[model samples]
Target: MNETRERIALLSKALDLMTDRPIRVMEVCGTHTVSIFRQGLRSLFPPSLELVSGPGCPVCVTDQGEIDAAVSLAGIKGVTVATYGDMLRVPGSGSSLVNERALGRDVRVITSADQALEIARNEKTRLVVFVAVGFETTAPSTASVILDAHREGRGNFTVLNLHKAVPPVLEALASDKNIALDALLLPGHVSVILGLSPYRFLPEDHGIACAVAGFGAEDIMLALVEVVRQIREGRPRVASLYSQAVREEGNCLARDLIDRVFEPCDSSWRGLGNLPLSGYGLREEYSSIDALKRLEISINDTSPPSGCSCGEVLKGKMLPRECALFGRLCNPSHPVGPCMVSSEGSCAAHFRFSRGGDHPWKH
Candidate 1:
């Protein structure tokens, strides 16, 4: 514990030394956002350095159209929708999975993709559709389960693949002029799977300093220090500070599993609209278990609530507190948006940990 504090103090001093000017850094992982706030790391940064949250929460980023589609899927007769628990309360155009479940629709919260497959194996008469939503970190597990279902001839098993690739979305964010980010604290979990190769574009193409960081205070501080150091040196590049978990080459086996079962496709985000080649679709070989193909479900684009600024929050354009609905009409108990509904969401994290404003340490 003492060593962690000393390391953080050194990193904080390093950050203070390098941050001569205002630097806006976005932590592109929901877990990072929560960790920053939970550990009071937001207060440790230099006054010139600002940390913002990005579209890192999978539940928060799952488009309203996709949510509505999943809700619609749940209402279908003989169809059982299996999804992560965080997705249960995310509002759709009209209803959520939880609401549908209450309305007698068979929507079940699953801890793993394999559970959905097991449900399919047990209930042969019913169609079991797993709503797969995550970044590259979780996609390999979902892919593995899909393959298992295919091999076991679980004809009733299918997956609504809302799994998104992180690189394309990061490219989109890097190109956006409005954000004008100086650096990025990359997701450690996703980086463990993708390695450092996929993120080279951030520094090479956009001139943004980025570093892969873990959830711990020391790990995040090390990454932040590296980012500030890169900025100070005028040599913006991608660095892996969380080398214990992340590698330069990433996990080849996991990538192989993802590639074997899924193909790149255009995907829509909550705020970022449709990004090219940003989502994963099951490959032709896995069409038998592709929920959209097998179930013939249509997904129509839907807008957010009238007063919710969840989209702005997801894009790092607006803070969670800036939204009028935050902590007022939209608490975790009665969420007005996905950002409030999701545990890893920026709004939820802010609501739980933040006292008033951006400066949590002050309060």
Candidate 2:
């Protein structure tokens, strides 16, 4: 614990020395958002150093059109929609998976893609469609399940592929002139698959400092200090602070599996709009398991909630509380937007930890 305090003090000193302007470091990982809140790391920062949440939460950034497509599949007579629990309460255009489930639609909350595959194997008559949503970290697991289904000839199984790539979106964010970001805290889990190579573009191309960070408070603090140090030295570079789990080349086998099963495609983000080559679709070889093709589902372009500023929040342009309906209308119990529905969401993090105006940044 003393070691933790010492690290915090060092990071604080670095920020105090380097932060002449508001240095906005966005953490592009939902787990990081939760960890920052849980560890009270935001409060430890100097006033000039600000921690902002980005479109890191897969569930939170999932476009409404995709959610509607999943809900539509759930309502089908012989189809069962399987998804992670975080996606249950997220409202679609008119209805959510939870509401559909309550109305007797077959929507099962699953922990992993393998569980959804097992459901397909057990229920021969019912078509199981797994809502495959995540970054590279979870995409390989989904790819593994798809490979297994293909090998076993599990004709009943299909995947609604909503998997996104982190690096592409990061490039898009960096290119955007509206988001004045100083540094990036990359997702450790995603880095475990992509390695440090994918994030090199941020530092090399955009002159932004980045650190692949772990979830612990000490890990985050150490990463923050490194980012500040890079800025202080006038040398922005990508550094891996979570070297224990992530590597420079990442997991070659996992990346190979993902490449084998999926192909890059243009994908729409909640706030960022359609980014080029930001999403993954099942490869033609696995088209038999591609739910969108098999079910003839079309994802219509949809807008966010009427008054929700989730898009701005996801882009780090606005804080969760800066939204007009953050707590008054969009609480966890009754979420008006995806940002409030997912536990890793920025709005949910703010609601859970800073609703009482205790967040140091609010001052």
Candidate 3:
């Protein structure tokens, strides 16, 4: 048989080997979340195997106060906002960055944090503010830009520090007994930066097998197979199925840059409450450029639209439909929370495919 057929056969065999009649595994990456839904992968897999999404999408999990802060910053004269393509659409207190952009405000889309520094250096009149988002995968890049800005003396450039660490969030999830995940399909993007060295601690320390897997349909299927296989064979360990990107030591330069630019700070997740040392803050020397340090804004913490269960969804506790606004009121166009706004969010994926229909299996 061909390689494709061989892979499928392996997956089928792996599923058959699962102990205690199948298991539940979570894809902790947002890209994986969207890809799984878009490819209609669930219908292809056995009903016994389940794939639940986690807080892999940074934009989706970013607290509502952050969205509001970004919109509030948008109105400041001579302040230029730079962010990934994802944050442009997320609504903040009835207004998204895009809505603010419609009123002729300055909002720039940047691939790397260095690009924002370049703009800040050249445009002396504009205060270049990078809307820093993402987990370990994207955080290193932001760290690189911050170090470069400080080294080059680019004072006009500052980041709205919303960067988060991966492992702590994982710990928070694992500590919660309610999750009951048999194994975890770790994020590929974050693994590319941080590598599998630190993740060895997950299995050794947390007693959970973390398979660093790719985001494609076939990649995820293979990961699920391996995860199930490990449990059945009575072997729990951290392994990399997507060796093309992930390594043991990870990217050293990226890690060094992240270390130099920022320090660990207490971070609050949308679903999981405040996690100690889960977020990043600008270092003391770089504090001059940090917007949070520069401008003081009164942030009022409010519940997400009363019954909106976006937080619970981020934690994988509830499905998208569990929320009253899932399809009726909350959607890509008119999002009640960040989950609906972000393309990688679980709610967006379910709304896009699972809506006007039902899942083939009973969860």
Candidate 4:
């Protein structure tokens, strides 16, 4: 703990020495968002350095159309929808998975994709659709499960593939002139799958500094220090501070598995529109188990709630509290938007940890 404090102090000093101008560093991982709030890292930073949350939470960033499709699929007879618990309460056009489940739809909250496969294997009469939603960190596990189901001949098993790639979204954000971002605190978990090579575009193409950081206070502090140092020294590059788990080349086996099962395709994010080659879809070989293809479900684009600013929040253009419905009508109990529904969501994190201060930097 003492060493961690020392590192934090050093990071504070580095922030002071870095520049007088305000620097906005976005952390594009939900775990990193929660870690920053849980460890009170925001209070430790100088006012010049602001930490903004991006569209990091997969459940939070999932398009309303996709959620509506999943909800619609759940209402179909002989179909059992399986997904992580976080996706249950996300409001779609008219209903959520939770709402459908209460209406007697078979919605199963699963821990792994394999559990959904098992359900399909045992319940041969029912169709099990695993709502796969995540970045590259979790995609490999889903890929592995798909391979297992294909080998075992689980005909009833399929996945609503909402798996997104991080690098392309980051590139989209970097290229956008509206968001004034100085550096990015890359996701350590995703970096473990993609390694350092994928993030090179941030610095090489966009002139942004990046650091792949772990979830610890010390790790985040060290990453911030490195980012500040790079900016101060005029050297923008992608550096990995989570060296214990991440490598330059990343996990080749995991990459190969993902490539074998899934292919890059255009994907729609909640706030960010359809990004080219930003999502993973089941390849031709895996079409037998692809739910979107087999079920022929029609997805309609749905708008967010009337007063919710979750889209702006996801894009880092607006803070959670800045939304009119943040705490008044958008608390955890009755969430009006995905940002409030997700545990790793910026609104949820701010509501739980930073609500007292109205503005985080002011505190």
Where model 2 places Cα greater than 4 Å from the true spot, the runs are: 357-363
State the lDDT of candidate 1 residue by residue for 34-60, as single tens digits: 888888888888898989999999999
lDDT of 3 by residue, 135-237 (tens): 8888888888787787888878878989889988888888788987768989998888888887776677667767988876678778877777777777879
Q: Relative to the unseen true structure, what is the C-alpha lDDT of residue 239 in candidate 2, on a scale of 0 to 100?
A: 91
TM-score of 4: 0.96
The 10-residue segment of model 3 with minimum total lDDT is 354-363
lDDT of candidate 2? 0.90
Global lDDT of each model? 0.90, 0.90, 0.81, 0.90
Cα lDDT over the full model 4:
0.90
**TM-score computed on alpha carbons, candidate 3:** 0.92
RMSD for each of the candidates: 2.0, 2.2, 3.0, 2.3
Candidates in order, TM-scores: namely 0.96, 0.96, 0.92, 0.96
Clashing pairs in 3: none
lDDT string for model 4 (191-253, tens) is 999999888989888889899999987788888888887887879999888989998999999
Model 4 clashing residue pairs (backbone): none
Ranking by lDDT: 1, 2, 4, 3
Let me know the TM-score candidate 1 reaches against the reference structure: 0.96
Q: Which of candidates 1 and 4 is the stronger one according to lDDT?
A: 1
lDDT, candidate 1, at 184? 96
Cα deviation of 266, candidate 3, in Å = 0.5
